[model samples]
Target: MKIIVSADIGNSETKMITRYDGVEGSECFHQPSVIRKLIKSPQIAETNLKKNVINLDENLIAHITSSALNRHSDGLYVIGKKAMQTDLNKVQNMNIKLGNKHKHDIPVIMILAMIARTVVKDEFELNGALESSYQIDCDFVSAIPASEFTFEKAKEFEKRLTKGDHTVVIHLGDKKVMVGINFKKAKITQEGIPAIFAMVYDNEENDDRKVSLLDKFNEVYDEEMEPNDLLKMKIFHVDIGDGTTEYIYTNGVNPVIDACDGERRGVGHATEDAVIMLNEMLQGSFKSSRQSFMEIIKDKTHNLHSEAFNALEAAKGTQANEILEDTFEKIQNKAGNSVDLITVYGGGSIQFREHLEESLRDYAETINSKLLWVPEELAVNLNVRGLDILNRTVFSKNKK
Candidate 1:
């Protein structure tokens, strides 16, 4: 069966969903947007394991191991969780860019390969197929930040991704499975705020017989509204990722591109502020590691069991509020009036939800905007979900 895959390659994580015969299948799969170069180990050479490593013509790769979660690797580099476990100094968070040019960076290639590997593995497992070399035809849909979403930029991304076939070998349990993927087509959508807007607005001009992502999101979120009415509602979409916070306005139907803007202030900024506050409170007693600090900051329920840590959380909360306040003010300045609905999504939405809500409360009366936080469980996958819907509806129709 031909499969369609939609991926949202965010700076913090990559979320993907797969579809078979135009029907969504399987739960979303996600991995950290991190990669690390492997330091050669003597044991590997002694075991003659070098031949097993899958070379991508790049310096790094997504490490596949015996774990069902694919979190281990014996390659020259590692991606995702395995990469995170490596020396913090060696692991680097990928910096995804929003521009009109293609980036041939190692992280980007690793992510693409990772997505393909994941789908191929799942398909094989479901079919109870033995481990062997197999070829699959796939159509891919992915997204970039909305601020740089243009025809030229989308074409550039598609060009990069479809230049040639890619092969990925993943070790699952004791079996080694090799997958050769031939991309039949690729669609690139604008992520961040615009993608969220697209998630809510169903375009009648596209295909009239299909349910859109907006329909799915509304159903999941328990929102009852007609598509026509939803299209008329003015919305301000706030997409807070690890590296950037994008602000976009939609007239319920189409994006108000001129009113869109982005800032580098996001969860990362708040985390840094929190770390600084904690260090000050502990008087240098609390040494912060990027990995540990990020975990604590992102997971709201993490118990650090220290007064300084609690105080640090509070400081981060306050900083998060400040960032949102600044963002709102900037949007108001450019748009003249606050929107009727303010929707928030992206990884940072869950991390900083309370602070964002608190900050919005301060301006609730003046802004007269209702907050709509994408359900916590679905926040990270919102963009890709929308892209998937677009692929099934618009792209599928175009292909026909």
Candidate 2:
């Protein structure tokens, strides 16, 4: 069996799109980038779990199922939303400054877990018959932060992913099913440049929905860009991630790598700040990881809901200012002051959109440059969308 995929192993979430033959499997899927090793694996699912956690628009699905992943790792691990439930859930610390995240076990584990999630999820849709144990060949495209991306680094990451068969065991209360994964191909594009490809390709039949986003972009940004204008424009992009920010310049269809660079410190700083404040409020009686803190902010009925929201909101506001200021400075240094357009996107971009839009719109008007916070449709999943497009492009070529 073969699974083609496009993934972005982000610090906050592992976002991906799985393809069968040459088309996307409905749409994208994301796993919270939380992983935890279990000393004792819990009893297999007693409760009937629902498929596809929550439905986000545009065929996107989130994974929350708990499954054990052993992809060249030291021990059995739980990932996605399931890992967040563990007391010792491990998340990639966004505080690390360009420290090569893909070099570690986390990326490999997350990628394998993502593939497993897909496999377990549309089992009947798979081309071949399913068994208790079957091997899957995976061809995929994913990206790493520009701050840490290099040809050599990418090659190393590719080697890490394809080294051997990865095992993912799914416990279904009565029995367990194990699936083996083989890396047929993997491509790690730098984060800063892929969003443009998102504008270029989409697998869905009713892709005209994307036009609404472009319309929104034009109306708010005071620009008159038709469908084809973005790809033709001299574009500057600021991708604000959890732990880092990247600046990439694209003249027409080509990315100017020499003008693309990134630095540490992004929305992760706010997340850390909120976590510290929350822990302090609890008087150190309990511990909460970044993942938990986010959940706290989302849960309004939680005891510390108000406190968590306020703390996170305040921290996010401050960090947004700092990140945007730092971004402009870096843009001037690397990508220069003038460009036909400027756009920003990422998970960080979504969380900090209000602040970013207000400031960036004014900043753009000041320089007479059009600005887009990159419509919500293309926001957090921008890189993965682009990578998926690239994956299809490659897959089509191979088929030919």
Candidate 3:
């Protein structure tokens, strides 16, 4: 059977989901959105190979791995957390995963790497072993920000991934393998639409994240309306990420162009500022990058916990306020009266909720509209989960 995967190539991380477990369930995978260009040379010690396990395409490569693509790209790179170990200064840090960057080779490579790693894990699970080389056929689905979710952008993205052969050499412990993802079908979905689809269709009854859309609609509207009316009611979705936040207005699953926009002020900006401030404040005594600072602050028992605990909190509050006043509040002021329901989600929503929850509730109450701060556990994966749901239902059916 051809593999079906739904992916979200986020700025801070990449999330991909597949119905590999079964039709009723899914397996979600994550990879850090980090990559670095590397030169495979004698400079890479044998010890480094043992640690990260990458092999060069040499005379011995034929004995250990198989090839499908005629020639690999000259730009050799490492991605995800492993890439983080290299020059921290040079690593592909937080950047908006939209516009030209969305269709660039790095993003495409990241997408393929996520798929390749997932396929490898599944292979190990199914067969209780690893493969030296594997090339799998797949149906790929991923999304960009709703603001850029246009026909031209989506087509360009699809062309970039499916236009040419995509194969990568991956490293394992003391070994290497070539894995390729051949996308039989590629789909680009808007960021928030899929989450709404998940809410309406794919949510589990017993799951705490399972929101009652119809029930919410009924409670809010207090009127019996046909299913067709569901398409007419406007629902605004606010998706917050580490590097970007998307404010989208939707009638059913379709985005309203005039009301939708994306901004660069996200949780990452706050953490980054905190990192810079803390570095200067302590005179480089406790050196921390953004990711390291976040990790340090989260771990209560860490040595730097005392320093990070409250400093980052202040930065977070300030950043959240900036985001609220600058983008979300403006969106609320302009569109509140016209919109029926407002839903807030995405990976970084959890961080901003403490500051935003009550204020949003007040506005929502004042405007006679309902608000949903999607449950934290479900927020991040909702988009990809929805895409996964479509992959099994609408997409497959349309293919038939």
Candidate 4:
């Protein structure tokens, strides 16, 4: 039977999907695109074969995905879930930073290969163990952001797969998601759409980090607000992440505005803080290396617990509100009647959902249309989902 596998690999997360015939299969396998290793026998380095896993120092690839860079004697290298156990001081590459620096599809290809290997290995092992008569192989269909999609790149990526080619698409949209179908296949037709930038730098001040349709609100909606004594309120939204924090602001119905002044906090620092606090608050799992904000808070952190914890207690939707409310209060004075409803989303949405909800409730009391707080899954994946929608629309139109 013919098989096609689609892989969506982003800096923050990796998703892999497999399909038989034309229908999407069950769950798509996924993993962080990181490998950790330690020096096993430095002197024994000689022959080399195809690169299977990243070799940091050549040990047994301890931990295998992430590891601490401690100069200590014991080589306990770790990667991914295992590497997250160490403090930021000890570990690096936890965020899996990838952008223009590396080849565009390098990270995704690595992740796809890993997924293919795992799936192929499992099928082979199980079939052999059960003494089955036949063997199975996999083909991969990798996807990239539609705005950034390219047929040449797709072809190059397919060539590297060696397993099989992948179908690539671009994901778009805000609350509603869409995808542009055959984005790689139709270069001329798809060129009209605006180019979307990867979230390399949250700040637009950087020359390379231009604003996108995602930041449409920031571009249009020309209005201003001065702090109003009546509401006596200020609001700020921060998209806290492993590498940086994104801040958006509003006084009262002036539309969400980007805050100019803020700190570039890393995910490791935020995670480290969360880990320390959770360590203090609870025992058992929290104390163990497996402890995550999702486990303790029973919500997603995407690695932004420290700020979310504070936001929750203050009844604010996002951590940015807590930190930058003062600035917003100043802008609230000249504002209109409508209280600004803050919508926060990202990998850290679940981390601050409870807090953001409380903040929205406060907005509802004074304003119309209640405050909005979209979760991380929807927030980050919104564009991809949007592209998918576009893809379907185009497909139907073409059929007609």
Candidate 5:
């Protein structure tokens, strides 16, 4: 059985979805985009939990479901939730851009390995088939930020990914498994702004609804009818992420290469600001981390200390206003008059939806343009899902 995998490796999170013969399966995985080295302790190294261990050379690594742990000659490494619990200091944030030269870096290799392992597991579950040797062929579709989507950069990414076959050993649940994936082919594209494609594509799937959403959008925005007509429309697409906010203005279906912009401000920046405020409220008495604070913020049932909660709410409000203000100013300066449609997506869209909507109202009124805010749950996965749809509808046809 052949497997097609579409992966989005964002700064803060990694998401993946797998399919076979153009049909999506039940298998999907999401994890924090963090990796850390596990310091070797004589106690851990000497202990033998044979069933829960993955042996790599002379080192033995414990496999925990919530984290990624692997043993190497230098030391054992942990990733995902496990790394956060083990040692926040060891956790490395993989938010920087990696060019052709850094393909062999530990983080890059580990991410690739993780993707391969996910695909293998999905293949087994979906097809009820596994090769005796646990080897499989993969057609990978992935995306990078719009600012780095140049021909040279895209090629560099592709080259690094398709360098050769890769093998990795991982412990999932109680099983020790080794997976080898051969990159039969790979296609990488710019993602941030192009995520608008997913909203358009989803509209096409739900055409039976009372109002054809895209049709109404086109009527209001002066966009062309066909999906491929995206090239002819003027679009200002904004993707607010955890670590960065990227916006691009396109004169046609393709992005206006020079108009792409990315800033370091995002939902994460706001969260950090809030955490600082929370820490200050406690008189620096309680040490707080981003993860811990986020748990409180997200969990409606979690009882927050009154003073800390008030501080957090104030910081979030300030941060949201600032981000929207900055983003609006950039849009006004860049494509305020020329843009026909404004599209917004990504994690920040949901986090600061009220502020964004309120701010966007002014822009829409000023420009008389249509505004498309992708649904909250769909926002984060827009790019990867769009890649999957593009593969099935466009690239596959071209291959024939």
Candidate 6:
């Protein structure tokens, strides 16, 4: 069976979806970009074991998980997280002097490889019917944000990924309001940045402050808030499981001012916004079996709103529709006249679609461009799709 592995490898999480012969299937996983490493007695690359010792190079054994986590015989490995979880302490002082950032790329490669291997193993077992003689298919499509994108980095990713059957790494970023597209082909195209967040911001103004639960705060803690102080306008960056949004400002002013919602400051605000949206939909009478807001994200929405269907239904009819329209308007205002297309994506894109379409429609009245609501399947994997297109152009010697 032919297999395709598509990944949107972002800072927070790396979401992966695999398909047999280019069709959707249930066999997939979303792994955090967290590697737990430990330097133990005898190094053994193990999956899901508590104390499996494995050799890192030779003398020092490193116990690694399919999650790319390694824990040492001592507690040093657990002291830090992410790329820092590795046993740099065990390495020579010279290597440590060169620093963690220098060691970052190699470890990232190892972590991704391990995760991919895990996906392969799970799929093979689940699809045991075909495991006997079926060819182990491996065509990968991975993506990185344009802000972190560079020619050399793309080449390096292409090299490491070559271990698979065939791979493509798409690079996506914003060029003004337009989405830039780069693919491996005779031709290269950089168009517009997908307006997923832009649409969200458009609806920001009219979203009953109640929806964000900030309305009570605005009233109770009544105070004239400055753009800088009361709201805490931070140039925070977020790399969702699918895409990255970096706050690029000049003299402390964001280019997409309207789109700025203070949520980019941290994962907490972003999570809170999602919760507030949920709570408001319940009309302040929501209850859930899932304990917290974070749980809502991991689980299904229907499950969370099962008890408040009527409130949710009403919320849909009123706030949801208006919010969507407002979102479209905001995206258009931000785009001005430069963009030819607005491609939308991310997990919330479907919920934001009506607004996106409305905004695109308003845009069509003046601009001669198309607003493509990349199909839901594509929405789930657009970053990978965009990255594949980028890899084609960046890696090709012909420079198409």
RMSD of each: 7.5, 4.6, 5.8, 14.9, 6.4, 16.9
List candidate 5 stretches off by more than 4 Å. Answer: 21-26, 40-76, 95-110, 123-133, 204-232, 285-292, 303-312, 317-322, 394-400
lDDT of 1 at 190: 60
Candidate with maximal lDDT: 2
lDDT of 3 by residue, 1-44 (tens): 46788887777777888765234555677767666666652133
Q: How accurate locally, in lDDT, is each candidate?
A: 0.60, 0.69, 0.66, 0.35, 0.60, 0.34
What local lDDT score does residue 229 receive in model 3, on the 0 to 100 scale? 52
Q: Which model, 3 or 6, shows the larger lDDT?
A: 3
For candidate 6, report its TM-score: 0.39
Candidate 2, residues 232-285, lDDT tens digits: the string is: 777888888777777788886588888878777566778888878877878876
C-alpha lDDT of candidate 3 relative to the true structure: 0.66
What shift in Å separates residue 47 of candidate 4 from its native position after superposition?
24
Clashes of each: 1, 0, 0, 47, 4, 38
**301-388 per-residue lDDT for model 5 (tens digits):** 7666555556666666876776677667767787656776677788778877776775785677777766767666567777776776
> On a 0 to 100 scale, what is the lDDT of residue 64 in model 4?
16
For residue 147, model 6's alpha carbon misses the true position, in angstroms, by 3.8
TM-score of each: 0.74, 0.86, 0.80, 0.41, 0.75, 0.39
Error of 2 at 348 (Å): 1.3
Better of 3 and 6 by TM-score: 3
* Tens-digit lDDT string for candidate 1 (221-294): 47865546656778777888866777777786566777876666566665556667777776876664444577
What clash count does candidate 1 reach? 1
Q: Which consecutive 10 residues in model 1 have the weakest lDDT in total?
A: 63-72
Q: What shift in Å separates residue 69 of candidate 1 from its native position after superposition? A: 25
lDDT of 4 at 397: 36
> Which residue pairs show backbone clashes in model 3?
none
Comparison by TM-score, 2 against 5, better one: 2
Locate the minimum summed-lDDT window of 10 residues in model 4. 170-179
Tens digits of per-residue lDDT, candidate 6, 1-400, equal 4444445544334455555544544234443343333443223235332121121111122122221122221121221122332443332111111222112442343334433344334443565311221224344445334334444555555554442232211111110011111212212111122223222232332233223212322453364432233122322111122122321211122224333321122232234344455667668664321113334444456566443333333333443354344434544554334443333445445534553456544654456643334445434434444333333324233443
